[model samples]
Target: MSLCEIVRLEGYIQSSYLAVYPDKIMLLDGCCRADVPMVLDYIKTTLKRPVTDLKVVVVTHMHPDHAGGAHKFREETGCLIVSADKKKQWYSGIGGRTMHFVDIHLGYYVARRQGRPLKNLYYSASL
Candidate 1:
């Protein structure tokens, strides 16, 4: 798998793109709740590299930073985004589901499990 970092637009969010194969790619985190183009530029460049073809965008859960770029990426790259089911509904503009948020403790736990320091914890919802 290959990973790429795409910084979000100022006052926006951050994102990461993962390419599992030359013909497949999944977006780990998205730029923000709305549209953010800088992140898009990052991914496009990465795909253009004669390396990998980004085909899918997957998010770990809901939240703008992780879920925001799904639609745009799909439109731009013709990539399909697979997100946590609950989040998928939200992005479809048919919002009527229970909204739950992530906690810092769980975040810390995840970081620890990854052998990362808790204080250095950061997340891109698109994991």
Candidate 2:
């Protein structure tokens, strides 16, 4: 069985999950982009592992709160970002585009709070 930890983010009011395996860890949601440090701290202090030990980050949904920190996490940990293998049509339509735009804008705040600019974002869709 895998061990699960709830990564609590400040002000966001959403809980992210971290699954610990024998040799690696997996993140269920990226949480808020601004909360990257908190997530990393949990891994280091509680999980007692280097951030590099994280192997996968699964964005449960395209919502900003869910996938917001994915790109940053990937850059810091070299973990693979995973989403649904099938891109929902909603993800390519105007609504999806609008949401993505919002996410990008929100990332700016996160970057500022973290005192670092966010890198170019990318995601790998897979099962």
Question: Which 10 consecutive positions of candidate 2 have the poorest summed lDDT?
Answer: 118-127
Look at candidate 1 and tell me the lDDT of residue 13: 26
Off by over 4 Å in 2: 1-11, 87-94, 101-127
Model 1: lDDT to the true structure: 0.48
- Per-residue error at 1 for model 2, in Å? 7.9
Q: Kindly list the per-residue Cα lDDT of model 2 for residues 56-109, writing each as its tens digit.
A: 998877665677678888999999988767646335767767767766666566
TM-score of candidate 2 against the unseen true structure? 0.66
* For model 1, the run of ten residues with the poorest summed lDDT: 91-100
**Relative to the unseen true structure, what is the C-alpha lDDT of residue 44 in candidate 1, on a scale of 0 to 100?**
64
> What lDDT does the true structure give each of the candidates?
0.48, 0.69
Clashes of 2: 0
TM-score of each: 0.47, 0.66
lDDT string for model 1 (1-127, tens) is 4443443234232335454454455556644433335545544673463212556677665565566556666666676667555534442432322232333344445445757533522323332
